[model samples]
Target: MGERGVQVGGRAVLPGALRPWLGGIAGLGAVVLFGLGVLFAGDSRPGVVDLRVWAVVNGAAPPWLYVAQAMDFLGEPVGAPLLVGATVVGCLLLRRPRAAVLVVLGVGVTVGVAKVLKSLVGRTIHGDNLSFPSGHTAFFTSFALVVALLVAGWLRVGRTVGVPLVLASTLLAAAVMGWAQVVLGAHYPTDVVGGWCTAVAVVPVVAWGVDRVADGRR
Candidate 1:
């Protein structure tokens, strides 16, 4: 099945067949869980309570809110420009042009599918919907995950060099973006979960498909 996802030290195994099928499975689980939360969050009051809990934990005023909203400092498409460029460069550098193209497709699918899920379920966003499975969160997460995983394998350096540092920082950025989504009230918790699920599933599955094609061509 040519399972090759997020390899670490040449020994890392994908959690599944590293195929589209597995990605679909992961995605479905995420959707089901989100639906359950929507259906049985007790009631609107309960939902509000849960949100308030997060608000308190995030502090009376989340710094991310200011950071996200300050358009003059940082406009929309926060990561889009960087992501497009990075995906292209990463593909070229890795000699995985097909994988790179597939990643773009995968990200597109994530956004499209998220919209379908939101509309089909008619799940009203506590924050906003058209907002189910936060596109911004998913988009940035996919960006980080793709860059991290793609570059991770090729990063060979002297043993003394900190190989894991870059990957860790990328992952940390994704985490921060997810936190920002929550703090900014751009998405609810479930929306963030859905966003993450959409990304991991799509990227690995798409990459797996790309690998098959590239290997065949070779």
Candidate 2:
């Protein structure tokens, strides 16, 4: 519907609004496609095997493995968690409690849903059933979304320019993180796509709903 901006770090930023809906739909599409790939093709198929082989091959390179290791660290506590935790605290300090709450809930739901889907789907890699969805990818995607929304709301920059810039940059970073997971043999391609979809599907809806409730209260 309508768009609004909040102040963060002394700049105006836009909260979750239309972008969330658009992103949610796009993400849902990815999830659906990949879920079908997983269900119909099964893990032993050529598509899955080929991608995994490529990742393993490229990953053997010193440079690629180094990059994967670095990206892997980001998904850890000192990386995504630290970044998200700090961002949440920043939103609270800036008096945007709803944004902070959205960050927490969005990430929580993304992780929780990923876990459930992985369990139900029962895809395995390296003897781990959790391979159906890459938790690292989801975490990084949610982290990017939080930062993007926070920056949009904090900067007075027009949504037309700011939203696209933030989204593009964040999505690129998220993609890199997903690639790293694949390179490290941590997940299948479908798993990484599934993770990205989870964040897209969950974050926007939850953020929008939180904003709506906050508006109702006001």
Candidate 3:
């Protein structure tokens, strides 16, 4: 598709020219593998890697703790909706309705899946709080993915540039959220990994589906 030809149904949808579906597939595989590992490890206990990472991240200096709390707030009830709403409004202003829909579905579905998986995995931290996949991490990562995809589409960049842009954005968001979750004692390091992977597994497919539906209607 040409740069301007990427539109569907007279709206600027996801750029179908860039190939993110392959990354989506790999993400799904990672989620499954991580889930199986969680199951095998049983409940409420940190793995070897989790222990090491947690040891490093769980305790923080006072100043750094404040920074972590600020980052954590972005995933909290008050902050999350604000972020999502802002992104949706921004997409609408840019005339990218499909991208706006994607931001909604991407964040909602990713966080929803994390919640469901917490029940299925039955992993707990700090007593009865389920924490297999950190919902906060998933929320931020999903939002980041949607934003990156929208930016890539807007820039009309191809896989060579788009892929790196998306990956870098995703990794940065995930790392920040993951650190906050760990530092706050909300989840283990592996739980943060699961949440990050969930967003990676979900957002591209959601984008593709949005594009497919828009194209079908057209």
Cα lDDT computed for each candidate against the true fold = 0.53, 0.67, 0.79
Tens-digit lDDT track of model 2 for 41-71:
3353325654665655566478878988999
Error of 1 at 218 (Å): 14
lDDT value for candidate 1?
0.53
Collision count for each candidate, in order? 0, 11, 0
Q: In candidate 1, which residue ranges exceed 4 Å CA deviation?
A: 3-49, 57-64, 70-79, 93-95, 126-128, 156-174
Arrange candidates by lDDT, highest first: which order? 3, 2, 1
| TM-score, every prediction | 0.64, 0.77, 0.89
Residue 158's C-alpha lDDT in candidate 3? 78
TM-score of 3: 0.89
- Indicate the residue-level lDDT of 176 in model 2: 91
Question: CA shift at 203, candidate 1, in angstroms?
Answer: 1.6
